[model samples]
Target: MSRSPKINTVNEAATKYQAAPNEEYQLVEQAHRGVPAGAFFDILGFSGLTKEELSGLLDVSFKTIQRYQNDGKKLNALNSEQLLKMITLYQKAEDVFGDLVSFNRWLRKPAIGLGNQHPLKYMQTPGGIDLIMDELRRIEFGALA
Candidate 1:
């Protein structure tokens, strides 16, 4: 006879992963709390996403995806493929949730300051600042790339 797979409680998963006491664990805890394997399968089915589909969408190997599901790997940040999917999802969600005008307004506002004090200071260079500026201007306004 085959042994059963281990089913982890939220507290057990959280403790095992040492997840910070924050929103990330809260989301998972809420979703998986008091849920059995059947419920887990039902939720995944409801999303209309197959394991293969999710693997492609996440741009991760199927094994990596399985690791997350079976081994309880914590995906704290979006990978490139996930980030692209999130951008598209956010765009659609915003349309249905009403205009995110206030959010876009911040992006349109002119950035204040130059040099190290500016938010874009990281883009600025300490060595050969004039040369870097020239190259950036050329790339931005000219086809010199």
Candidate 2:
């Protein structure tokens, strides 16, 4: 039986990978207060994205985002979810394209399967993310459009 994808939070991913060799790994039951607000920086580094672009994509203000970084506050549930999703997408893109640069380039161009929409623009919505992921799957299966 195939297991479904677990929509893990940033902290959950960290903890899972950080598990001690002798200990049983445990997934966090909830994300509340588990991830730092500044964890976006990690995602930004992995994705080679700018803070301004991410703020714009997530529809957050620069000053407010600065406060989150300065205060080291925990991201709220919604923001955490978005951050996790973006990281997951980046990882998948890397796996498929072999490098961040290639994946980033592909994200900026209009994809034929995506109705000629730049995949980067679709990162803002869950539905758009699903579409992009579907297109990636098609690419993997040699079903290029």
Off by over 4 Å in 2: 1-34
**Candidate 2: tens digits of C-alpha lDDT, residues 1-145:** 2222343343344343331212222212123334565556666645767788887777877678767777766666556556655665665676678777888889889999989989989888645766787887788778974
Residue-level lDDT of model 1, residues 28-145, one tens digit each, is: 4533432222222222332333556444544566676445547544443333212222222223323332433432332233333222232122222212222333333443454432
Candidate 2 yields a Cα-based lDDT of 0.63
Pairs with backbone N, CA or C atoms under 3 Å apart (clashes), candidate 1: none
Kindly give the number of clashing pairs for every candidate.
0, 0
How well does candidate 2 score on lDDT at residue 129?
66
Q: Each model's C-alpha lDDT?
A: 0.33, 0.63
Each prediction's Cα RMSD? 15.6, 9.2
